[model samples]
Target: MAARRKANRILAAVLVPLTLLTLAGMAMLWPSGSKDGISLANPYSAAPGVTFDTGKIQSVVEESCMQGSTAPGQSPDTGGQPAPAGSDCMFAFTEPDQGGSPVKVVVNPEVAQSHGVKPGDQIRYLNLSNAPGAAASQGSPAYIFVDFVRTLPIVILALLYALVVIAVARWRGLRALLGLVGAYFVLAGFMLPGLVEGKPPLLLALVGSTVIMIGVLYFAHGFSARTSTALLGTMFGLAITALLAAWATDAANLAGVGSHDATTLINTSANISISGVILCGLIISGLGVLNDVTITQSSAVWELYELAPGTSARKLFTSAMRIGRDHIASTVYTIAFAYAGAALPILIIVMLYDRPLGDTLTSAELSEEVIRTLVGSIGLVLAIPVTTLIAVLVVKATGVRTAGQSAVGVPDEDRRPHGTSGAGAINADDVDDTGALAAAAFERRSRQSTEGSADPATTRRGRRADRG
Candidate 1:
């Protein structure tokens, strides 16, 4: 008990101060509401007499790629050059939701060739019918496809995911979902704004991630030695991941130059550092997987100790690590496959290039994902044993009891059934009353069978009858 108290005190000493410091950092680094430094062009910001409207596709048709059909952000052909034979474009006839005549909208060529729209699909379009030059040009374009409306399907999937989680895990799952919301709140409210203000990326990620874990762990799992142990393990893993990510981002030169979005950010804002963003991403990407392994390892240790209360600390750790080994194997694959799936398009593009494996992997396009998987796997793999050891020590300190005695090194008397003087009885006191009763009954039956098997008169009678 005293040892457990000491462990708790140590955890508090570490966590409480860290949390206070993180909060202070957040307060100091909070962003101002001004957007003075941002100068990115907005594509969807409509000019006078132009509107962005939603509509449902009435029908789609493939027509010749001619001079008049212009896509969004495309200018009308003024060279008077005829389109090549066999070239075509997709045009969707759509009815506006705001009560207007059906208009023919030209779909973007990339969208049309990749994922063409059909009738009854909701879409957003830029309506330039009332613009100044609309009446001057011949066959001037009116509506152009901007994007597909995807709100309904996304909302449906989200609801289904929530229902399944809550249905299976009940109130705990609900609390976890709520904690996820809180985590996002911190990410959006504190961390993102801080990044926008050009705060230190490494410190921003670490503080934000730690605050998230602390909130989610206690809020979802509640306050206990087990949870605290898991929290400590998670923090340790976070620190390792952060340090490695910072080094890898610099050493590997993950400048995010290969990504279009990254390039846009470079052209858009001077304050944002692509390398720093990549560094922050590398750290944040591993948080969920790290937390999973650590908490699971901690729980496995405690459960092992509960099942075999007399087990030595070393044995308990060994048993727990057996589970941890399996978790580590699966979690590594999980991180690898998850990143692979997200980067599948990039992989396909690189594969088509038919480049050497090493070259492809080390390329700017693929290097970040590769490094992310490796770094996350390393952090989580190291956390497993640490969590297992901490849990073993804590469980050993708070030893289980039976009849006012520690279950570890239990007395012989306590190992036997009450009101009986028989050998071969297992330790009934190690388990609850119901299990103890079942053990005693089984022992009694075994003793009776042994006595019957040793009856000399009965054996002789059976042998004589068989001979006759």
Candidate 2:
């Protein structure tokens, strides 16, 4: 009991001040909570309000859209090379908010194929003011050409994912889901806005993710020595991940602006550093899985000690490492396969390239993926052992025992490795742990109990002869 309190005091002493400092730092560096940086608009372009929101296609007509064109039953084309502008294309759409109210719009055949639209399709409209004297009023509604509506599908998927997780994991899963929400809050609230404001993306990622680590692990796993040990290990792994990401990014000459989206972002926001942002993403991308590994290792160590309370620290460490090694192996494969699956399209393109394999694989796109995988793998692999070590030490230090019990001392006879030669080969100090001594005492007790029982050979015969 006393030892457990001492451990608690030590952990509190370390974590309390750390938490206060973290809060202070976060308050100082938190973003303005404004989204202006990311919501960039071209000042010369059309107003945002003029654009149409999402709507559903109501009806379609095959009649001519041009002036002085006949109805659909009459002949609209002669040669059939290409249909005229006002020929065979009209669509009616109704906004979701305003049901049963349909708006008609002409579709240009030239650009008609570019944006395919049919009846019952969910789409976004471009409110063009083509009608004569047509204003932005209901009587003269703007032309509602179709784009796409992606909102509903994504929302449905998110809800489904949440249901499955909570259903399977129950309470623990509920906490994990909440932790995920908190993590997303950190990313969207801090990391993203920080990047938009031209803050060092790598630094922002490290700080924001570390803060998230503290929250997510403790919140999902609970606040205790076990969770604290996991949190420490995760933080250490994140630091390693950041360092390795930086080193690998520069080493591989990763421009981080390889994709079209990145190029567009850079052109629009010249202040942003694409490479730095990519490196930041790289470091944080490993955080979720790294947290998983560290936490599992921590829990494993504690649970192992709980099951075998009399085991020495050395035995506990070895058993925990065995689990860690398996986890590391499986996790490494998981990382590799996951990255490969995401990059499969790029891999196909690279495979099609006629250049040598080395040349094709060293391209900017492939190199970024390579660097992300390798650096993340290294950090994850190291985190397992590091986390295990910390957890084992922690549980041993913090665990409570009954009177005359030991956390690091197993039975004296149980200390030797299996199949070891006679006792002469083993030293007394080596086999002198509480575990061994306990086992020896237990054996003595069992022998005494057997001897104290009435002798089966004498009881019946002695009684019969004496009575005769």
Error of 2 at 161 (Å): 2.2
Q: Candidate 1 residues 1-468, lDDT tens each?
A: 554566677678777888899789877777775667788888889989899999999998886656334543355564777667776778898899998778889899999989999999999999887878876756555788999999999999999999999999899899999999999999998878777767899998998998999999999988777889999899889989998999999999899989999998888678888888888899999999998998898888766555446556776676678778999999999999999999999999999999999999999889999999999999889989988887877777666566645445444444344444455445433333333434554654565466468779986886599579
The per-residue C-alpha lDDT of model 2 at residue 291 equals: 91
lDDT of 2 by residue, 1-468 (tens): 565466657667877786777677667667775545454566335554455546777666644443112322345344555546644565554444455455555455644666556777776666555444444333232564545677889999999988998899878788989998988998888888777777776678778888898888888878777788888788789889999998877888788656886777777666577888888989987987899899898888777665445556777777778778889889888888989999998889888877787887688768888778888999988888888887777777775655554544444344333334456423223443435434544554454465448696785775598579
List runs of model 2 lying over 4 Å from the truth: 1-6, 33-39, 42-50, 57-120, 129-147, 399-404, 408-468
Model 1 bad stretches (over 4 Å) = 1-10, 67-84, 400-404, 407-468
Quantify how close model 1 is to the true structure by its C-alpha RMSD in Å: 8.1
Q: Give per-candidate clash totals.
A: 0, 11
Q: In model 2, how large is the Cα lDDT of residue 186? A: 86
Candidate 2 C-alpha error for residue 75, in Å: 6.9
Question: Among all windows of ten consecutive residues in candidate 1, which has the lowest summed lDDT?
Answer: 428-437
Give the candidate number with the greatest lDDT.
Answer: 1
What global local distance difference test value does model 2 have? 0.70
Each model's lDDT comes to 0.81, 0.70
